[model samples]
Target: MTAAPSLDSKYYEAARPRSLGERLTGAARQRIHADFLRLCRPGPETTILDVGVSDVINDAANGLERHYPYPHRITAVGLGAAEAFRAAFPSVAYRQVAADCRLPFADGSFGIATSNAVLEHVGSPENQRLLLAEMARVARTVFVTVPHRFFPVEHHTAIPLLHYTDAGFRWACRRLGKEEWAQQQNLILMSRRRLAALVPPGRTARLGRTGLPLGPFSSNLFLLLTP
Candidate 1:
């Protein structure tokens, strides 16, 4: 059987200048960085488990370690290109993991666990839940960020409204001679309510909004869950 596309594969790379929407998204990401640091309070001795590594070719600031104060204590996990990623960022530890299995880490192995704009690309809601549960199991606090469905334009395709409403959009793109984009089936747009429901019950979840001014309808959503 053919293997699924890895997160570090060239299929995910977008090497271009930031669009107006992307610049706005970047602003929101900055807020997420600050909030994660504030909430997690990482120190030189604090062990942080970063569930997904960022696209080093596209945006350098997209990774958690970019804003993280202590790089020596951060360990990043990814599903591909571990050698290249490790060589590029030698200071941080890198681990390769299977896409469909449990994370190979002990319970409470780290002080904090985090992922950036990674939830939507994990395939389905079930896979997303598995990732969340693993993150929670390995750390006392979890900080994750995913694209908000209410955002006017989808970050991956740069298409507005149609992506959220049209399930056959990828198929239509293929018919219209855009075959490359049609292969992106992993992205799943999520709403604030749906995102909130994914959090474990009784946990303190503070949802933060970032981007252009519609409040919850912002471009990105951040979920900060603490024990």
Candidate 2:
């Protein structure tokens, strides 16, 4: 019999890792960065609009900002103050934007629109689709990643098994006194089917998994949409 991959709880927060989780996240993000470059194949002149970059100043926070060779070609947007993110990536332009609103960019302004592990935090399913639609509107190609819903560990709250179900996950979160996580405003896990359904009717989208690929149990899922 084959051995199943071990996903230790200490490093389960792949979305936004902390402490011991950071080591796992750093490595996983490196892999994600490499895959992004390989699959998206952006050129030196390709302007990238990165959606949902965090204000957190950790080394693992923004993989593209850290790994991309041309920071000047990257424009990042998020819901937090850009001061910290701007300080971290001085050459990359940063913009502050609401999570659910249309991106403040003209149509086809960028060659690519990219986001990592941010779709789950955008509130309802409607908001999630809106983010995708906005990304599609502003760029000819869209590359977005979200934590896999069935990836064994629940990312935000870091609880296992019980988080497989929304009602059960909320009940467990409340019992653990994590009131914020129990709220729908914080997170909504994603599966490939759910993600596929979010793409606009006429658009062409390719879905794949990367980062800690334990087959169907891979830690992350990505959507690559192109015109």
Candidate 3:
């Protein structure tokens, strides 16, 4: 049997990341917050669930509490130990759960659910579907963000070549000495197309761009779906 891929959690957090500018720029940050507001349509009555939230340095959950308009409660889930998340978010509610596994919440428990650049790491078609399905099942509306496959050199992955092709991503990962995990490209590519089917069969998928014009396909792709 092939040995499981080992990822350096600390290294992954340390590497200069692509979203740094988005985190640093006030205007960029506002746009993201605005887009999230537009996508989730959160209101005083709305409840939000942020899945795959990490607590280490540069974690998205760090400023999330401040980004969105307050008056609503937010729950965050992460792959890191739940205790770690609790410590980081202190007053906010949080949960630590496997990214590609089942969620710990009850069915139809939330008003909205959002995940930013998270689905790509899930690494399995079955698990991808499970994750999306869980999101749809629990929340009235679901919002997901992913790096468009066409996005250029967004970051290095297990793939050796960096042009967004499956082979290229695999090559990059291999170069990173993560060939075992590199094969997860299937999940990334699969996510781009398959997310449309996550909503109720009759609902249509709403695609939102990052409002950037570099290309018809921006590095960031957002989807909002409802029953």
Candidate lDDT (C-alpha), each: 0.69, 0.77, 0.59
Error of 2 at 2 (Å): 41
The local distance difference test score of model 2 is 0.77
Between prediction 2 and prediction 3, which has the larger lDDT?
2
**Candidate 2 Cα outliers beyond 4 Å, as residue runs:** 1-18
How many pairs collide in each candidate, listed in order?
0, 0, 9
Can you give the TM-score per candidate against the true fold? 0.82, 0.89, 0.75
Q: For candidate 2, lDDT tens digit of each residue in 139-163?
A: 9999888878777877666778787
State the lDDT of candidate 1 residue by residue for 132-153, as single tens digits.
Answer: 8888889988988877877776
Q: Output the number of the TM-score-best candidate.
A: 2
* Cα RMSD, model 1: 3.7
